[model samples]
Each structure stands twice: as structure tokens, then as C-alpha cells.
Target: MNDNTSMGNGASQQNHLNGQWQGQPGQQGQGQYGQYGQPQGGYQQGPPQGGWQQAPQPKKKNWFLRHKILTAILALFLIGSIASASGGGSKGSDSASSSDNSSSDSAAKSDDKKSDEKKSEKKDEEKKDEGDKLPAVGTPVRDGKFEFTITKVERGKTTAGSNEFLQETAQGEYTYVYVTVKNIGDRAQMMSESDQKAFSSTGQQFSTDTSASLALDGDNDFFLTDINPGNQAKGILVFDAPKGTKLTQIELHDSFLSGGVKASL
Candidate 1:
């Protein structure tokens, strides 16, 4: 009886110590199985693989629908900008062209005015220099670069009475004048029958008659001739006029550019 009582007391004491270890409600305890391998206090848990979730996608934008007024304003602003650029370019081009044309026209008119002014001044000077430009026959006149003397006047005559080849009867009566031209200039002087004109008393002018020129003998005509410096040309010019017409004066020119000298018949 003593051996059994000692064994029973030792077993009871061990049992009491084991119960103390499992005691206390709502106390710290070992982890139970749950999602993410975290502790769950006596609750049912899903599988660890089901804890993984896809992130939410961002919502797609509806830009036109979200800001209707801002979209309309941007569209109108773009159209206005395009229209203004186009119209401004065209207007600028037209303005530039017109300015260029106006500048060209102004330059042209300025040049023309200068030319006309120069011409007017030149003509005025020429008029001021013209003297002894008009005179009568039988008068000795001094013109530019030359001196003229009307020596004789013979009317109603065709040609001189040479040995042969004389035109005695002409279509109209003939008049003759003896003239002498002296070149007082430094250069050679030219003479032309066209430069000599016979004026009737009635103021009618006649050119030299060439019909009887061939029949006449002698170098008395001054056509197509030149006189050197300090030299002279003595010539006879013939004309045809109405019968009994009075030869009043003669006009002579040394050159086409010479002012000319006149002499009374």
C-alpha cells in the first residue's frame, strides 16, 4: 500500500504542471494557417495562392466629352488663325507690288522732267547766240566760222554764152547770183546748194535750178564741196522764177547747223 500511494502522488503532481502550461483565455498563441501566411485567431482562411490580385487599370480618357467648351474654343481659334494668316499674306503682297510700281513710276517721271529741262536750257542758249542769222542780198555778212559776200545778181538768163552746150530757153526765166564764201574757222567748211535759197520780192522761195547745170561750163556751183581754213569758194547759183518777178533777197547757210546769213538783191 505505500508503494502504490507514492506512485499515485507523483503522477498527479505531473498532471497538475502540464495543465498550467495550457491555461488562460485570450492570450498569445502560436500562428494558425491563413492568407499571406499571417495569423488568424481561430477563423477559416483561403489558400495562400488566392491572395495575389491584379492592380486596377486606369480609366481611359474621353477628352472631347469631358471639356466640350474648351474643345470648341480651340477649334474656332485654330480656324481664325489660319484665315488671318492667309488674308494677311495676300494683302501684304498686293501692297508691296503697288509700292514698287509707284516707286518705278516716280523715278521715270523724275528722269523725264530733268531731260526736258536740259533741252529747254540748251535751246535758249542757241537762240541767244544766233545773230546776223537773217539779212538781205548784196550785203556782206559774218556768220559762225565763215564770211559771205554777194558780188553780183543776173536775172532772166539761163547760162553764159559759151562756145557750145548752152540752155538758152528754160521752162521759166532763170536768175543767177555770184557768191563768195571764206572759211575763217580752224576747220574745213562745207557748202550745199540746198543751203542757198532765193526769195522773190513777194516772199516766194525757189531752189537752185539743176536743169541747165550740165549745159553750163565752169565750176561755179558750190554743191558737194568743201573749203579749207582761210580758203574761199566762188560760185554761181541759178534759179527759175515767173517772168519779170523781182528777186528781193537771198538766204545762205554754211552748214545745216549754221545760223545762216542773208543778203538783199
Candidate 2:
């Protein structure tokens, strides 16, 4: 019985050693499977099955990339804003420049108008200055003569027996006077001899005679013969007055003699 018992104990020891060896192999296998297993809970939770893993799933998408897109949009917005500002500034500058130019033009026009007015005033002054340089008519001088009296002084006329001659006188004792003169002293003396002969054929004569039975208060006509030395002439006379009348001054002027002489009657 003792021998049998010892043999049984040795077998049991061998069996324990075998069980330990088997347990060690099983633990090693479990460690290897833990390091490289399929995903658990629907997610890959271990190291890669091949030599490398999927590069950490690329870190979801990445907020920086999204930020880049937003930044591009912002940049575009900035560009548009800058362009609009520049355009507005240019337009305003152009408008201001145009206004300034117009103002300058208006000022220039005003200056021209002022200059024209001044010129007109200067011309008017010159014209006034030119008007102060002429001569005026003067009164006359007289002298005595061989009993000269203006019988009839009137515009000249040519008619039978009165070709530029004094034809009528009053019924009084008087001396007639006829004077001929010119304005510029440039015309020839008297009518030609032929003209005088023709006038005489018409019973016309140039005379300064007085008659007792003559009719005055009518036209006294005469022809211009010559211009006096000073382009002037005078006719003076004396007449038989009504008993106690006094002699007076005489004045003479034009010939044929419309506007001839004035006697203080």
C-alpha cells in the first residue's frame, strides 16, 4: 500500500507541470491577439494589421481648411470694397475739378466785359475832346459910301428887264445899292459878256439909281460879280426922308440878296 501511494503522488506532480506549460503558451497567444485584433464596438481600437495604420484617419476634416475657404471669401470682399471706394473718390475729384474750371472761365469772361466797358468810355471821351476846336461867326463892320440905300433885297431871279437887277423903288429921292460877294472867294467874277448881252436884249440893266416915282417894298435882285478882298462887301446910302427923319445904320450880308441888308427904319 505504501508503494502504491508514492507512485500516485509522482504522477500527480507531473500532471501539474504539464498544466503550467500549457497555460504559459495560452497567455502568450492572448497577448499577441490583443496587440493586433479587429475593431471592437464598431471602431478600430488596436495597432495596424499590416506594417502601418491608416494615418490616424486624417484628423476628421480640419478646421484650418474650412478657415481657408472663409478667408478667401473675406479677401474677395475686401477687394471689391477697395475698388468701390477708389471709384467713388475718382468721381468726386473729377467733379471738383470741373467746377473749378468753370469758375475760372466765368471770371475771365467778367474781366473781358470790364475791359470792353473801359474802352467804350475812353472812346467817348476822345470824341468829346474833338468837338472843341471850331470857329464861330462874328458881327460886321461898316463904312460910308456915295449915298447908298438898299432898295429891294430879295432872292435873285431872272426875268424880262430884271435879270438879277433891282427893278422897283419907292416914290422918294433915294440912292440904290447893289453889292455882290461870295463865301469862299473862289468862283469867277460875273456872267460872261454873251450872257450880259442876252440879259440886256431882255431890257435888263444893273443899276444903283434912284427915281422919284418908283415903287419900293418889292424884291430887289442882283447878280454876284466878284468876291471882296476879305470875302465881304457892304452897300451904304442916303435917302430923302419924310421931312424930319434921321439916318440910321445899315447892315449887309448875302447877295441876289435874299438876306441882304437891314436898315433901321
Q: How well does each candidate superpose onto the true structure, as a TM-score?
A: 0.45, 0.29
**Per-residue lDDT for 110-192 in model 2, tens only?**
99999998987786565334322211112222222111233332222211123335344333334333333234334433311
Residues 205-230 of candidate 1 have per-residue lDDT tens digits of 88877645434557564766788999
For residue 197, model 1's alpha carbon misses the true position, in angstroms, by 0.6
Listed per model in order, the count of residue pairs whose N, CA or C atoms clash below 3 Å is: 4, 8
User: Residue 171 in candidate 2 has what lDDT?
Assistant: 34
Runs in model 2 deviating more than 4 A are 1-69, 133-265
Report the alpha-carbon TM-score of model 2 versus the true structure.
Answer: 0.29
Which regions in candidate 1 have their CA more than 4 angstroms from the true location? 1-138, 159-168, 219-221
Q: Which ten residues in a row have the lowest lDDT in candidate 1?
A: 31-40
